[model samples]
Target: MLLHVSPARVGFFRAQLDTGRSGLVLCGPKSLQQARRLRNTEHFSGPLLVDPAVYEVRAASGEEPFPDVAEGTFGFEDPLAVSLAEQRAVGVTAPMTPTGYLHAEDSDALKAAVRRVAALDDPQVVFAAPVDVGWLREEDSVRQLIACLRLVRGPKALMLGGQRDPLAQHPRAVDHLRQIVTEVPGAALLRTDLAAFGALAAGAAFTAFGAGSRLRHIVAPGERAEKSKGFAQSPHVLFPELMDFFLGKTLADRFAGTAAPVCGCAACEGIRALDSFASNAGDRQARAAAHNVAVLMEWLRTLTALDSGPARQWWWYERCVAAVAQYPLLNAQLLQPNGFKVPAQLKRWALAAPAAVTVQPRADAKDYGRS
Candidate 1:
């Protein structure tokens, strides 16, 4: 499991690191300063990925500006220079090559970015592509991406970023990810949510979810900004049993009940109902985010403990099936029929075929050079 670090929740993430449960920690351009502190600490020895977040630059220049892209955050015209410098400053030994969201039709741009990264001479370089989500819907595009990825000659990893929530929107997103990972080997889904679990079951090396809802998906360029409607932003609390997140206010208003489920994660200890997370008490948001991470990490541990690929896939399928089953029970508990809309990704996960075992041994990074 990969945890995307947010600057505000650095302390919470630091606490998580103390548990030694972290796999890969991803930090964005804005969080690099905090990530530097984490990297210099004794507790966090795991690999840290400092994402240049080139997609934000693309978004800011598009029809609808991404609100999150603060002016002058990525001041440089070339994101690669900024990316390499940031990684170096943070002491990332093997930095990822930063690239913007590639349109499927722009094969030349895709090939150029791939070749550019490959030429960087980093033996363990990661080729990161922030792609348009539509790529998954086009077979020719998927094939084009896979073919380009195969051209990397040395030890490398692939990090895929998509515009919006592809797993929820695209019917075959999971299968397409499986196919890509099968051909590309070391691939990770970036800026995703619970769908990352589906990618894991589909044979991805690991996947990342941001600490907050806004960071969960890449909002498409030209998309209108959502109106706040005078309500303060609330934390998105994950209900692990249901494999989904609920806004804190929504949980309190609708799901709070004597029979409401409780989380057993360390962060949630002593909390009677998950709805209690809705309270805006001191550190509630941070604590709630911690609970989300803890529960997901626990599930990751359970999945990884299984002996074979088929066993892991079966376990994931069963988990999805069980989560889906809870929708009706939750509706019944709330006395509101059809309160919860089952996520399409969750349903697809339940019906997914067992993945074939194709774990490949990673080549040692003997030399940080592009072959």
Candidate 2:
């Protein structure tokens, strides 16, 4: 799928996106206009925008923003906004990010609002899980996610959330979320938080990270507003290439003896290994970005071409799971010892860090994905 990793703003970005893929994810703050523009670009058949409320959470520690909406739900927009997004072939993704509780009443109010957002019948509406919730609270988040999923029962209705278990640091979240994706019937897409991409090998589903690393390769978070000229400030900074590399490597290594093909895209077609491309900063960064995108597209194409058979199932259960399980061990390789690439390294660090255990594992690990 054609995935446009962009910030949440509509007016900020002006880049030419690659659109041959099947889907697009607009990361960052939510913007109806930006969503429409993405749809107009044809890079994605249907674009999914991560909600703005994720950044509004107010910390008890007394951060700058008192009433933090960082973990808040998207109740500000009306159904018209969602409809407008549809006009541009983009979809709206709302729901909580799962952070600290503001108030019991407010939480309930937010839950009610989520239900209302899901109730809207539009061509593009995906109710993703709250991004702010702690992984230790997966049960609560899952319960809330289930409620939102129930309201949006159409074929387009998809579910999304960050991870909470096993590889909660890296690829484990993918496997954990995969259980939800597999079990959550009718789920069209899934999303991973900034930290989970490296070892996870997650898919066309929602993926977000810092902006500088992907589009402009911004070094400092403070430079986002000033330096982000032709790009959105949202999660577009975090492109899908992070996870794509993991998945592509897994596919190449696991199914090595089989007909599993290497990506024919410009990046991997004539290349031997990922290291063949110049991945260093400056001129090298662009080359790495190009190769990363190409490799990702190739993986998605192969995945899309696969038949819905036992092999696919086995792939998800075995290789996919194994890759995620390896997140903790493979994390060091995700980083470069060199400086100037700090931003990307930080994001990878988040994905590889261990998460506290909270949710009770189901009887069978397979139950995680059984619909």
Q: Which one wins on lDDT? A: 1
* lDDT score of residue 245 within candidate 2: 33
Displacement of residue 7 (Cα, Å) in model 2 is 6.2
Candidate 1 residue runs with Cα over 4 Å from true position: 17-30, 41-43, 59-82, 153-164, 222-233, 279-281, 355-371
> How many backbone clashes does every candidate have?
3, 46
Candidate with best TM-score = 1
User: 129 in model 1: Cα distance from truth in Å?
Assistant: 0.9
Q: What is the C-alpha RMSD of each candidate to the true structure, in Å?
A: 7.4, 11.5
Q: If candidate 2 were superposed on the true structure by all CA atoms, what would the RMSD be?
A: 11.5
Model 2 worst lDDT run, 10 consecutive residues? 215-224
lDDT (tens digit, per residue) of candidate 1 on 155-230: 3343444443556567876777778876776676766777677667667766776766656766554554353332
- Residue range 1-371, candidate 2, lDDT tens digits: 33435544222222322344333445454444566554566443443544333322332111211233323447664433433344344434332222222221234534554554455554244443333223314455545554444555442222222222112334333434444444454444323323223222223233332223332111111122233232231112112222333222333333344443333455445544433322233444344445455444444444444433332333333433444444443334434233112233333344432323343222233321101
The true-versus-predicted C-alpha distance at residue 56 of model 2, in Å, is 6.0
